[model samples]
Target: MKKRFVVLVIAAFMLFVFGSMAEATVANKQIQVNYNNVKIVTNGKAVTLTADQEPFLLNGVTFVPLRAAGQALNSTVNWEASTKTVVITGNSNNNASNTDLLVQIAQKNQEIVALKAQVAALQAKLDDEDTDEDYDLDKIEDKLLDQYGELEDVKIDEIALKGDDDFVKVDVEVDLDDYKKEWKDLTEREIKNWVEDLVEEIQAKLNSNTVVDGMIYSTDDEDLVEFYKRGKNRLDVYIINNYKGVNASKVIDSLEGDRYSVEGIRFSIGELDYEEDKELVNVNFEAEAADVAERWDELNRIEISDAVDKIGKAIAGEFENEDVPVEAVRLYFYDEDNERLGSYRYNNN
Candidate 1:
């Protein structure tokens, strides 16, 4: 335990017990004190007051600086703001060890600050790299423009990115002008090969979770003849019907409205004919149920025949109000191996 009472008494005595001798020493705009008068000496030398430190004399008594005296006696003096007290403690024999500990703590604090700075810099660099790899949409557009812009058969018309590059929408035009090979000329094998090439090239440069929304083209003479899509592991090639003065968009729309040419069940345009004597047009198509695995072998022949007959009449009805020359439709239900599952013909005359 600290000798609190003794320390207080010594501090009080040093601050106040000079008996008016301090005032006697001050006169003529200067104060002088010698060894005979009240003075504190450390190591055989008297302590001199600086401009900020002075003795207080009042009513025949004197006050001195206790902090100076306390330090000279090998003590550590501090003010405790929380307790409102002046604490004076004697120096320990291990004072040098305490000073070394304080220095080490300061050095460790500097090292920690430096390490935090390095970590922050590294995290910022990582965030920038991630933005480039996962969020930048412009890079994908530039790549498509460079590769598909100058192809002979097709050209990239538009590129759009959505949802942090999670989806890539590419619109392309298949050139069929100058009486070139129309989309109807492309066989199933050709369609599959083209779609495979496109998907393979794009996915090779993208992450697995990304989806590509490629719209081949629309009707009304947009300089495109085909749009390809997939249905439950089935590759689809849609051939646009663009006979002169014949609007086929309405017909396909009608087919989709009746659940005939969408998703699992789809239809493709086949051979077409126009009967000049009868003023009637004949449309041909290959209707397929893509979801049926091993198609022809797995499906029932009776059901297939009935389905094709209904589909043909439904197609003919779609052209009833059109300005086309005639209203007629022919449907061919076929698979790769079977070659012909069923067929139907209709004429609304």
Candidate 2:
């Protein structure tokens, strides 16, 4: 039979064998019982029974020992005289003594509950991301063409809008045909004014239906200039926009006398190394370490990555104000032992 061994734990039983074992034997006559060549087979396995406990027939009625049968089925047999009952039970241990399987079942149930909770959480996140907001790219691009098609030297090449909610992706490609100065000859003021105007027009004409985070003014797909919504005035600069390199020494002189501190790390600028070809600069600090830092002891025990980040902000900030030709700057830091702690590069600064 298909079965799971379940134990009721408490038990009672009555058997024919117990009657013959009474202390005060009764005066009685017994007839011979038949063996009948009986065999005990349980779930395809043979069970050996003692001769005295074997199957027998009394007055043509068949009987078997309860204890032997229960043992063959991996169970417990109990006899209760007061209740005149026989109880059979099966569980983790043969006699229902071990509860290890019950404990394991409870643990597995808890894990299943935890796993189901995780799945529910992930599903909630997906539903939140599946927003209904939509922007028609074709309609927006066509409207832009209608607004800027009349400028002889200006060409509107491509425009695309994507994503949902307040944050969205908007990229524009514009090409200048001819009758224009090289991009480098155009000053930062000139470049910033042109792009900002276009951005304002796009926002007004579309009734602010789209948000532009960046725009590229190119020639035959060659990126001549790109405007990003970051920097000193937030949207006031471009990458490699102004070509003439600034005097590196002058930029350093402006920041050398200044001292800045963040998270107990006092920092000062020493020298500025400018690479004209790469349009990059390495702004170095004066000393290997700083003094008069009250919390330096606390900072020395931890990582110095974010602790010393703002040290070079004054230098990069000054370079941006002067419309410096450099595209990026690298900042180097040292620990108390003169060992390099970390190096960081600020792009489009």
Candidate 3:
């Protein structure tokens, strides 16, 4: 116990000596510090010193406790040892260089944040515009029909009536089977007369004029006609100068075709019609490759192969099948000068 007490007393003496030495050094040495428009004080007294008056250094570093300097300048100083930086904060009482740097950083950050928000807003607006640009009316119409129900014979497919005008465009799909039973054994002349009589009856009901266009001649040389005959006998009747507000499909249903009407007719038709020019309605039939690449100056090797396969299938009359796959089909629309105006692609798988 005595030995332990001696050791403790010796340790205390060594600590006291070191503390005194530190205090002596602080009191003897003087430091000359220059601060921009800043004054230092200690214990409510102003501190003025020059670099030549007193120079104090500790462990290769100049040590100045900020509390003393800040009190003199009427400001506050904070030291962050982790980041090895000093923060000289200013208020109504004091102004400092460090305060200016912090202010500038905050303003720059705010600007950056605002710019980021603007970019995000612009991107969202562009997305909405792209969606609007891609809107397709044909697909919408198909979707609407699918949602409601499959259009049936004698049912009104669409009705567009102009309140101030006397003209309307009506689209109709007729069920040939309903009239085929009665005319199946009839001669071509009888069949023609029967069709004419039916059109007259429809015109009288609608209180409108009628004009019968030339009949479509079926060619035995075409394979499509043979394939069509293998399935069922069908006919398309294009009625012009009909009732202005009448539903074409409903009118067709009223007219007797086959002995009985079917549920709904399934067929594909091109979206083409006659346009009035001079004294007559010019009806021209034209078809071209669909989705032809603009860069194709002439048919490349790959494109030639594709064209051969497409033309071959078209000749075989299998191009109309929805399940028949084709690589590409481009349809081009041209004027009388043969200058291309627009193009479209059919990608049915």
Best by TM-score: 1
Question: What are the per-residue Cα lDDT tens digits for candidate 3 across 64-141?
Answer: 444444445566667677854455554663345677878999999999999999999999999887555324334433
C-alpha TM-scores of all predictions? 0.32, 0.29, 0.19
Clashing pairs in 2: 12-87, 13-79, 13-80, 13-85, 13-86, 14-85, 14-86
Please provide, for model 2 over 263-343, each residue's C-alpha lDDT reduced to its tens digit, 9 standing for 90 to 100. Answer: 646656644555656667676543335453334445643345454444445556676677657677787654445555556
In model 2, the Cα lDDT at residue 142 comes to: 74
| Candidate number with the higher lDDT (1 or 3) | 1
Q: Model 1 over residues 7-73: C-alpha lDDT tens digits?
A: 1225557534533334455456654432213456666655665645554444444455667777767
TM-score of 2: 0.29
Total colliding residue pairs, candidate 2: 7
**Which stretches of model 2 miss by more than 4 angstroms?**
1-25, 70-92, 95-98, 132-349
Ranking by TM-score, best first? 1, 2, 3
Q: In model 1, where is the ten-residue run with the lowest total lDDT?
A: 1-10
